[model samples]
Each structure stands twice: as structure tokens, then as C-alpha cells.
Target: MKSKIALLLFFALTAFTLLQNRKITGVVTDEYQKPLAGVMVSVPNTMISTTTDSLGRYTIQVPAYALKLTFVLPHLTTQQIDIGKSNTINVTLKTGRINLTEALADHQTVHRKVSGSYVKMESAPQTFMAPMQRYQPGETENYNPINENGFQVASQMPVTTFSVDVDRAAYSNTRRFLNNGQMPPVDAVRIEEMINYFDYDYAGPSGEHPIAVSTEMTDSPWNPGLKLLHIGLQAKTVPTKNLPASNLVFLIDVSGSMSDQNKLPLLKQAFKLLVDQLRPQDKISIVVYAGAAGEILKPTSGSEKMTIKEALDGLEAGGSTAGGAGIELAYKLAKDNFIKNGNNRVILATDGDFNVGISSEGALQRLIEEKRKEGIFLSIMGFGMGNYKDSHIETLADKGNGNYAYIDNIQEARKEFVQEFGGTLFTIAKDVKIQIEFNPRHVQAYRLIGYENRALKNEEFHDDKKDAGEMGSGHTVTALYEIVPTGAKSPYLSKNDALKYQKTDASDIGKTDEMLTLKIRYKKPDEDQSVLFDMPVKNISRPMAACSENLRFASAVAEFGLLLRGSEFKGKASYRDVIARAKTAFGKDEEGYRSEFVQLVKTAETLDNRKETAQKD
Candidate 1:
């Protein structure tokens, strides 16, 4: 009887064990019905876990005692569900706030290609372009070739649609000296005009779309008291649940210039942190450029994390820079293991020192431009101090259709890799361009702050072939424009006798409501053509006192840009104004970026006062 009891007990135990190992399977999606890949599905309170595949399908064995399961992705709000006896649980995740209509409303239209006529004009031969050379608004210029009656008269003025406000802070901060006057010491502080140009944080999708914006018109510097439209764009973060596998190639610059503590050494540590987060399917390749370019390690699976870590550790600073060779080798490796339809990228980490090979800016640019055609994306991580080439790095990133970032420390690496994984790794959209047309009636002359080099010819705004900047996930760019009304007593230039015949009468310009139009153009990551977005600016002015935290913060950033550039339009803008604006705009301060800007302002004040004193002496 005892033996019989033992056999029954054994059977019951075996059946329970089988029940505990039962499998659960389901597909994860977003509200849009798009599959969410790379989402983590795991039992609560245990190391047991599984990740979803590209199709958002997941399968995991659930132990009988497991009462709950959780789905998690970096930067996403985590979700948990109770697991009673269900064999499958389908999950859907909400994306971060990004309202497309709202964001595009305040910017200019972005189109795939400029109108054919505009292209023909831009590409016209030098002989036929004499009249188009210097823009004279509404002038009837005569063509050299005589018609049956006489010289052909044609209106020759560049068609411009948008205007931007210069940053007051940046304009005031610059040190200007009269010609042949005693110049102050050059303040070679490291400043990224572009990166410092805007304020963007990772916010979830707020409305139905991926971008949002609010625009207003304010006083212009050129025209006294005249108001101009100040438009702002707020892009929403895309929800990334299960992203595809990433094949990353790390091209390291170990040149002599990178021997600084903040250069080569910091690079290794930063990359190591990135490696710790890699999954088994992800692959990494290490390429070093010193005396010559060579691959330190072939593409290895992320499962071999230790191997990558060891290779990174073995890297040492020595020899001259062969940036050209390094890039070629890295691109070759990327092409060899091209992961079709996956994230294939070459991340170049350097101090911008390329002295020995492919050092010329033009040569390097050409190489990067050519390689981009192969479907391999590039990303540049700038490091180190003294002799840093911000321009070089910027050009490379721009032409390669990639993003550029400066790494001041390891914490920044986390922000780039772990915190902003989606923005940094995934390309949801590309080639974003903003163009705004100012109504002649609403305001007077305007100037765009910073992007002096990025300014497109009036017609280039619609040309799709012309490359524009790429916005990473959750990245926000802000532009401010000050406008003067027709009757406002601002410092605007009136058409003199030379321009009198070409100029339109002040009465011909439109009113404030019709003063400006915003246009935006962008393409999906895999698309070649861009979509157009347009919005009219006509809202009544809000009390400057009631602007949202985002608006105020953006204003402060604009001011900083003006101060740096030493713009002539810094009238009535004091250091006090910038600081006060920043203080009021400091909301939530999640990353303390605003607070840091405040400190930067203090430093800027000191610099400005010193320069003033030198001028007096």
C-alpha cells in the first residue's frame, strides 16, 4: 500500500512540473497596429526573460508560480499584466508625445524637389545668370541678348519664403573691435553653435501626430516696434518596442592628439558602457586609425560581449591620424556584413584630428558623401580638448547624412546610448527642412540665427535633392525671428534711390496676419521623396508673460546664440534679460540643461565685461 501511494505522489509531481513549463505566445503592437520589436517579456521577480522578434511576436515559458509578467523597453513606460492561466497575452504600447500637425504648423514647407523652373534658374549658365547674381527685389533687369525690339527685360529677384529671428543672447556675446583697433584676447572656448541652438527633451507623443508647434509675432530689430512671426517646432518621440538588430562599427581615432585624458581613454570607457547594453543578436566591429587604418576586430556577435570589451581595452593612443584610411576600412566592413533592412551604421569616434591621411576637409567630405550612397549611415562622436575641429566634425556628419555629438564624459554616453536609444539608434525620419515666408505687410527684414552656413537659397527650400539636417529621435530645433510692423519705429533699412525702382511701396506689403507662412519637408527613413507641410501664421499675440515653459526656454536659447555671434540686433537685450528668462522657463529640469545654461550665462557675462574693459583701455 505504501509503494502504491509513492507511485501516485510521483505522478502528481510530474504533472505539476509539466504545467509549470507551459509556453505563452503573443504579438505586440502599437496603437497604429505597427509591430513592436525588441520588447522585453519576463516573469516578475526573476531573471527569466525573453525578447520579442522583428514582428513583435514573443514566446516565453511561464513557471506555474509566476503570477505576473511585464513588458519593458528603454525610455518607454513599462506595462505589467497578471498571468492567471492564460497561454498568450497580446500587448500594445503607447508612443511618446509627438504631434505632426502642431509641430509643422509653425515651420516652413519641406518638399521633395524644388519646382522645375526654380531648378532651371539655379542651374542656369553663368552668362545667362548675370541679372540673377545679386538679388534686387522687383527690379526689371535687361538681358544682354536683344529681342526684336530691344534687350529683354525680366524681373530678377530671388524668391524667398521664410525668415527667422536672430538670437539676442548670441548677438550680444560677441567681441567686436574696430578695424586696426586693439583686439582682445581670443576666447577659444568650445561652443557647439548647432547643438546649443535648440532645446529638446524626450517627450512622449502628446497628440495624434509626431510633432507640435505654436507660433507668434513679436517686435523686429530692423523695423522699430514691427512684429515678426516666431515659430517653434515640438517633435514627439516615437515609441520603440522591438527595434531591429543593430550592426555597429566603431571607428576609433588613436592619433597623437587623442592622447589627452579626455580623448582616447574616455572613448574606450564610453564604448564599453554602450557594449554592456547590447543583446546577443546585435553585432559590433572595432576599427582603429593610427599610423594606418585597420580593423582591430571582425564583426562579432553581441553575445561575445567580453571579446568586444577586451578589444576596446587593448586600444592605445599612438601614431599619426589616418582618418581617411580608417573610414574606408570601416565602410568596407559595414558593406561586407550589410544587414539588409536592419540598422547598419559606422560610428566614428575621434578628436577631429586627421593630420596624416585624408586630412583635408574637402577630401574627407567627398569620401563620406560617396560612402553614404551604399546605404551605410555614419555617426560622429567628438572627443578631447584643444585643437578640436568642430567644423570638420559638423561637415562630416552633415554630408554623411549622420548625426554629430560631443562626449564630455561617461554620463553623456549613458544619455546618448541608454537614455536616448531610440533617437540615437533608430532613424524614424530624415532630411528635415524648415522654410517660412514672411508677409510683406506684417513685418520688415529678418535674419536667421546660427545656421549661417545652413541657409538655403530661397529656392533650395523646395529642392528635394538638396540635403538638409537630420533630426534624431526626440531632438527639437528652435528658431526665433523678430519682426517690425509697417508703422513701427524700428532700425529697418528703407530702399534708397538705387533700390527705389526695384522696391515695392510699403503699402504693397501685406498686413501682420498675412505676414508669414511656414513650410516643412521630411522623408521617412527609407524613402527618397519628402512630404510637404504648410501652415499660415495669424494668431493674436499672447502676453509674453504667459508663454509656456517650452517657449520661454527656447527664447533663452536664441538669446545665447545671438550673444555668441555678436549680432547687431542685440538692442534692449541685456545679460539680465537672458538670465531672468531662463529662470522663469526652468520647468521640471529633469536633465538640468536649463540650469546649466544659466551658469553658462554667468560665464558669458564675465567674458563680455572683460572684453569691454579691454576696449576701453
Candidate 2:
């Protein structure tokens, strides 16, 4: 009886201790009264901390004894406030000076001017930034390894095959890195994405096919002896208001790492923007994972905006990540509430940190692939930095027959969910593959620009079982190839002996004026068999100055990517050359995306110059 009493007392004390913690919430803003995201908020002298979300709001569990809170962010001044007699405290911070000479050193100090002295220095402010907030090159982040495609001899290998990729995450992520005052890793620069980021004024599909194709051939701007071939595909457009009813499951990550401002807070704001764009016929379910997974809201109609907003606003970040469990549960919910013939998808929002269960990328990929066969698609939206898993999320999106985007800010979110609603939520074509057969009589060697991983074997183009990429409504895909005319000497192509087994076939060589044959295969979103179409590209090459704006602009973007990657194949391509060419082709500044590309090039140029100057000093 005495031992039982002691055990009862222990349980009572544990309950009392758990009730001592309180949840505190507030927002952080800048001096201009705008909500400041990515701000670190912490209780001074403790391990408890959190980050402001897209709206600059944060929620942190504080013990009863905590007294003060602190906030910190890059390029922002640090501030602290007392937690006396209140559970909410908002703060506003000013800009901090960044010392170039001291930035690369171990310490950062703010300087001020004195009346009689040239300079007066102050020690760095006590900030709440976690150690994980600092970027360690090749340590905290991940990317797929890229190997640039090499030149192929038309006599030996005449066919080139690859899948069409429409994901613009690479371009946006690259822009984020550049905007943060750093150079992106070479693997992060996908030349195809960079070229396709801007909208092209291609003609719409007018026939039975769901796609319209266009081609242009022009002299290479970077290499004099090579010719550049550009192919563009525009998917059939569907107005956002006319899209089918959607059944979407938001699988969110609220792990400990997501306590950062750019992770959970930004994710919530992005989703809120998406929520505002949904039609009343659409349905949404939200599932969150952290050490465990659970559904926070049932299949709610899009018209219940207030209830959904409340649920989203109440989310708080803590605990480990269980990404796999979250995926399983989300798929289960989506399947249970499946909308036949309508849009059924799972939109995963995360930093790609899976630690507790099924964390291996291969395992997660297999799971997603299995679910995709059930007529449900998956889309991934990456958030935050310093601990991003680019390879993992990209693989999942590819395997699940969905597209991916990286949301760097609220503007990008609006672009994805509002400006390109149909393209973001609807699929127009699947298993889209392209193949080109070069004529040995006119072309000696050729190299495909970018798309190193999407390359496929020639025979796989006709195989129905081979999985390629899917195209969204109103999305445009572009590809470039550099061609070398017969008898032209090039460094990329190595001379090989004539084939001893057989003679080069010139049988249909003089019949047509075709330089190459382009073939495309695609299936309806629900169909298994792909439709075939072919066109012959004539050898009507034009000078760079005489080519269409699309060709010139795309070539300039590719040149910029090559320069950023420090690619060995970049011939005579310079930043100045890219900027000059891009400026000339900035057409129809409706969205200003093309204009932004030019500015990015200029920013990269300035950054390169600063690095050079620092090295010389």
C-alpha cells in the first residue's frame, strides 16, 4: 500500500511539471512595418527558440522561469525584450552594416563614426541564430551530380533521346542563392530550367493533338563552327476557372529544423495563398508529420476558408521528422476521398529532412511510385535553406509524375498558385519523350545542351513501360542542341576510324532537304499508350542577329548557366556577352521575368568582380 502511494505521487508530480510550460506567440517586423520573415526568435540563455514565418509570426513553448526573448537575422540588427507579465511580445529591427573585410573573418563587427576619429567599432550583437543557420559548402545541402552531355558522332550514334523537364525550381533556387549574395553550386544550375523560366509566345494547339511544337535553328553564339537548334513545345492551355474539381492533400513537415523562419512560416503563407485561389468545388486535407503523423483537418470544402485559416494559423513546429509515415497517411486520405476523373494530388511541403522512418530516398521514391499508379499525382514545394535536400525532393516529384517548385518568397508562391494556376495543378500530358535522328550526310557531331540525367536510350523511346516526364497545362518546355557541319573540326568530337563491320548508309540521303528528324511521343493523363508525331528540321540556319527572340534569349540563358557552372564546354561565353545578348531579346515585358533574368546576370557579374578583387588583395 505504501509503494502504491509513492507511485501515485510520482505521476501527479509529472503531470504538474508538464502543465508548467506555456505557448507564447508574436510577430516580428522591420522598421518599415512590413512583416520580416526568416527572423530567429529565442529565449535568452536557453535552448528554446523559433523562427518567424512568412507573416513574421512565431510560436515557441516557454517555461515559467524564462524572462527575456531575443531575435536575430542576417542583415538585420538584433533586439531583445523582457517577457514579464505577458505571453506575447512583438519586435521591430533595423538594418545592420555588413563589413566586407570582416565578413570573411571569424568575427563580424558594426562600425560607427566618431566626432574626431575616423572610425569607431562595436562588438557583434548577441544574436539568437542557431549554428545550423550558417551555410557550410557541400555539407548541409544536397544536389544531383551533373555531367554535361558530350558530342556524339552521327555516323556512329545518330539518335538522341531525352525526357522533357518543366520544373523551374532550379532557376528559382539559383536566383535565391544569388540574391543572398553567394554563387550557387554548379549542380543547382539546370540550363533547361533557366531557359524555360520565361514564357514564350508560342502558338497554341489548333489540331487534335494536345501540344503545339515549334523549332528554330541558328548559328551558335558561343562557338563559331557549331549551329544551335532550338525546339519548343506548348501544352494545351486550360483556364483556371474551367479546371476540374481538385482533391488535394497537403503533407507538411513540422520538424524541429522547420522552426526556422523560411521553413514552416513560409510554407504556411504559401499554402494560404494557394487556399485563396481554390474554387468551392475543390476539397483539401492537411496532414502534418513531426516524430509522428496525423491529420489536422478532414476533407474540407474550399469554401470553408475561415476554418482552414484557423487550422493553418494554429500550427507550431517541434520534434523529429517522419516524412515516410506522413506520405503513407496522406496517400491513404487522398485515396479514400478520391475524385474520379478530377484532379487528385498530394502536395508535399518540406525541407526534405526525414530522420525517423523510411528516411532513405530510395524507399520513399518506391512508395511514391507505387501510389502514382493509382491515378494520383504528387507535387513537391521546397522551402528554407542551410539544410535543404534538393536531390531527395526532385527524385520524388519525378517518380510520382508531378512537377516541383522551390518557393523562395511570397512572390514566387503567388506566381505558382495564382498566375500559373492551371499549369501548377493540372496535367495535360504524360510520358512525354523526344527523339532526334541526325543525318550523317550533313552533320558530323552534335551535343545536347543540359538535361544530363533525363537522357534515355534510343530504344526506350518506343517502349510504353518506360517512365518519362509529365507536362502541365499551359507549360512550355524547351531544349537546345549544338550541331557541327560535316568536315568541321571541333575540340569536343574525337576522330574515330570508319566502321569495319558495315558501310555508312546514304540511301535516302538526297531524297529530302531534311537535316534531322524530330519525333515526339506523349500520352493522355489517364492513358497508357502514347501518340506519335514526327517533323523534319530543315537546314535553314540563320545568323544569331537574324534569329527569333526565343532562340537568342534561350541561347543567352544557356550561356549564363555554363558560365556559372564553370563548364569545360563553354566556348567564348562571358558574362558581358550574356548580358548584352539577353538585353536585346527582352521581349514583351508583361510579367517582367525576362527583365529579371537580365538583372540576375548583372548581379552575378558584380559578385564575380568582388571575388576577383578580394583574391588580388
Best by TM-score: 2
lDDT at position 104, candidate 2: 26
TM-score of each: 0.66, 0.79
Model 1 alpha-carbon drift over 4 Å, by segment: 1-213, 219-228, 492-512, 614-617
Error (Å) of candidate 2 at residue 418 is 0.8
Ten-residue region with minimum lDDT total, candidate 2: 111-120
Q: Write the per-residue lDDT of candidate 1 for residues 382-460, one digit (tens) a residue.
A: 7754466555676687787777676654445555666666667666556677776655444445554445545567677
Q: After superposition, how far is residue 242 of candidate 1 from its true place, in Å?
A: 3.2
Instruction: Give the deviation of candidate 2 from the true structure as CA RMSD.
Output: 12.0
- On residues 40-91, what C-alpha lDDT tens digit does candidate 2 reach at each position? 6776655466667557788888777777777775444567788888878889
Model 2, residue 176: distance off in Å is 1.3
Model 2, residue 421: what's the lDDT? 82
Off by over 4 Å in 2: 1-139, 505-508, 614-617
Give the Cα lDDT of each candidate: 0.60, 0.82
Error of 2 at 588 (Å): 2.0
